[model samples]
Target chain A: MTKRVFKAAFVSSLPVLMGYSAMGMAAGILLAGTVKLKFLPFWAFLSSGINISGALQFIMVNWTEALLPLTQVALLTFCLNVRYAMYGFSLIEKFRPLPWLKRGYLIWSLTDETYALEVDSAARTPAGENQLDFCLGVAFLDHLYWLIGVTAGAVIGAALPFDSRGIDFAMTALFLVVLTDQCQSKINRLSAAVGIISAICGRVFFSTSNMLIPAMVMMGAVFIIFRGKFERKPEQKEGEE
Target chain B: MSRETYFLCMTLTAGVVTIALRAFPFLMFSGNRPVPPVIRYIGKVLPPAAIAMLIVYCYCSAYQDKSFASGGFGLPELAASVLVVALQFWKRNPLLSIISGTILYMVIVQNFV
Candidate 1:
């Protein structure tokens, strides 16, 4: 039974394998070519293994090279990944009955891709198949793919003879893709406009290195001051799901 | 601090914060306490706003050192970004969109500029 579940999980995770490996290689290459760190592959492996976050993995290359203050790093990390906090709400009941170790691993590895697969697998789980085992199988395989992609990219990047100029644009492209997807909703569009205006204002008033916090502050203020406009109505929220 | 130690500290800080945030909902609302509406609203709206803010920041950083008269007058950045958004919107394939857009930007900057 366990073997069968693992096989099913592997089949479902093939798409993630491609996505993570390609994306991870981009991030790892950026880290190696941009940052001046020695033992580049080791750092790549460490950051990828620990964070397992797509955006943060890319952004951290900049943070390390610039040696940004810890407070700023923490805040930026939170702003970029705050969505993970809400992912747990849907998973709370399902994970409550799990053992401490198993639950902890699941929570730790609750990336956007992994979370989506877990939820889908649960809904479609065949009877007599253990859901927890399937979840674990998916989580472990995804984690391994990310690790391999990043480390391999670092190795290749360090050995490359050609210039890697303009590769950092991958991060910008990623952000644009995500924003385009999000803007499909009315509420998201309003919030994104506020964010763009706030960031432009921040760039005008503050240095590029110091703009993010101010932008975040302005964004939060706008969201609060106009909560009624931004918050979804109950019926609209239901429709979204 | 040495660079190695600084990197380590930063990694640890980021890792701990990430794990804590992921664990938040489970730790707080496990026992039947309803999530606050304000918190829920922020969670829903923050991702789009934050992502948009980052896109602006990327543009600012890419052109920070170059003026409008130089580096193809920011044309590469603008053109490539448009291509990315358009391809992503049309194909809905992230890898295709990013790879094609980045390659175009690279060729323009490396050869034309």
Candidate 2:
């Protein structure tokens, strides 16, 4: 039974393995180039192991270089990751009966891909399967893949002597990929417009370093003010099952 | 604080904050209680907007460069983004899109500019 669960979870996570490892390598290489610290791969391992976030892994190199204020770090981390909170809402019932340790690990590893797979597996789980074990297996495998990717990138980056100019565009390309997917839905298109406008306004009004918080605030305000407009009608079943 | 200490602090801070955010909903509305309508509303709508915001943030960095004019007038970014969108739309394969786009940007910037 455990073998079957692992097989299902592993098959489901292959795509994430490809994505995370590739993206993680880029982020890891970025860190190696930007930060001159010795034992860089060790840091990469630790940070990637704990955070499990793509954007933050990329953004942290900048913060580390500047030694940005801890307050700013806290706030940016919050803003970047707040979406995970929303992801938990859909899984609350599925995860309700899990023991504290397993439940805690599940929440900790609830990345976008892992969450999607967990939810997918849950929906497809046949009667009498150990759903909890399947999810845990998926989370653990995804986490390991990410760790290996980042660590490998760091090791390779440290050893390479070639100029890696413009590799940072990988991060930009990632965001664009996510945005393109989001824009496929009509409602998301409007929300995206709100975000883009809010960000542009923030950029124009505030200094570059200070734009994010204001943009987030503005986006939130706009979303709330037009909730009726942006929020789908009750009959819509877009929420994850 | 020492550099190592500072780095550790930053890592722990980010980790703690992320865990808190991920766990907030579960802690708040466990058991049979219904989630607030407003919270559910935000959950449904916020992802697209936030992701859009991040995309803007990514490009804004390049725009912030002091050498924007010298940086091929942002042509590399624009071209690569177009490639990514077109390829992703056609293939719907994220790895193919991202890797191709990033490599194209790298090649363009490395050779042309």
Candidate 3:
């Protein structure tokens, strides 16, 4: 049964394997190149294993190289990961019966891809297989893939002979891919437009170092003020109402 | 602070904060309660906007570094991004799009400018 669960989980996570490893390598390489540090791969292992955040992984070099204030580091982490707070809402019931350790691991590894996979794993589970076990299997495999990718990239990054200039464009391409995928929906397009405008305004108003939080705040305000316009109609209630 | 200590502190802080955020809903709403409508609404809508903010942020960072100066004023970034979006639209394969776009960007910057 465990073997079946692992096989199913591995199959489901194959797509993520491709994405995480590629993107992780880019971030790791960027870190190795830009941050002048010994034992870089060790740090890569530690941070990636603990955090499991793609965007944060890419930007961490900036924080380290600048020796950013602890307060700023915490704030930026929150800003970068605040979206994570919502991922657990949908999974609360699914994970409710889990033991503390397993649940904690699932939450810790709840990256965007992992969350999507875990949520969808129920349908993929064999008829008699346990949901929690399947989810746990998926989570663990995804985590390992991410760790391997980042650590391997760090190792390769340290020894590469060629100039790695502009390799950071991988980060940009990642964001663009996500944005393009998200913009396929009409509602997301509206929200993305607001985000773009707000970010530009923040850029115009604040220095690059200070623009992110302001832009986030502006987005929140806009989202709230325009909530009535964009809220998806709760299904099954429109006709009765 | 020494460099090692500073990095250690940052790693700890970032790790803790990220864990806290990821665990927020589970800790707060573990009692079988329905998620608040406001929270639900934000959850559904925030991703695209946040991702959009991130893309702009990336562009701003690149601009700050003056990467455009070598590429005839940001031509490489502009062109590479167009290719990425176009390939994503056409092929719908993220791995191919990202790798090809990034490689294209590296070539443009390394050789052209």
> Of 1 and 3, which scores higher on lDDT?
1
Candidate 1 Cα RMSD (Å): 3.4
Q: Model 3 over residues B1-113: C-alpha lDDT tens digits?
A: 87667877888899999999899999999877877777777767887887788788778777775656654588888999999999999898988888888899989888888
When superposed on Cα atoms, how far off is each prediction in RMSD?
Answer: 3.4, 3.8, 3.8
TM per prediction = 0.95, 0.90, 0.90
**Cα lDDT of model 2 by residue, A1-241, tens digit:** 4777788778888989988999899899988877777678999999999999998888887677667788878977876787898888788888988889999999998899999988877664546678888898899999999988998899898899767877777777777788788789999899889888988898899866778789888988887777767766744433232
Q: Candidate 1 chain A: minimum summed lDDT over ten consecutive residues — where?
A: A232-241
- Candidate 3 lDDT over residue span A1-241, tens digit each: 3898889999999998988898888889988887877688998898899888888888787777667688878876876677899889889889989889989999999998999988997798988999889999989999998998898889899988678877778878887888899899999999899888988999999977677788888888887777777787743222111
- Relative to the true structure, candidate 2 reaches a TM of 0.90
- Residue lDDT tens for model 2, B2-110: 6566777899999999999899888998887888777777766777777777677777776665588878888998999999989888888877888899899989988
lDDT of 1 by residue, A66-122 (tens): 688899889888888899999999888878778999999999998999999888877
Looking at model 2, residue B79 earns an lDDT score of 97
Best candidate per TM-score, number? Answer: 1
In order of TM-score, best first, we have: 1, 2, 3
Interface RMSD of 3: 1.9
For each candidate, what's the DockQ?
Answer: 0.80, 0.68, 0.68
- The true-versus-predicted C-alpha distance at residue B69 of model 1, in Å, is 3.7
Over 4 Å off, model 3: A66-68, A233-241
**Residue pairs that clash (backbone atoms under 3 angstroms), model 3:** none
State each model's TM-score restricted to chain B: 0.88, 0.86, 0.83
lDDT per residue for candidate 1 within B1-113, as digits (tens), equals 87777888898889988999999999999978999877888898899989999889888877767775677888998898999999999998998888888888888888888
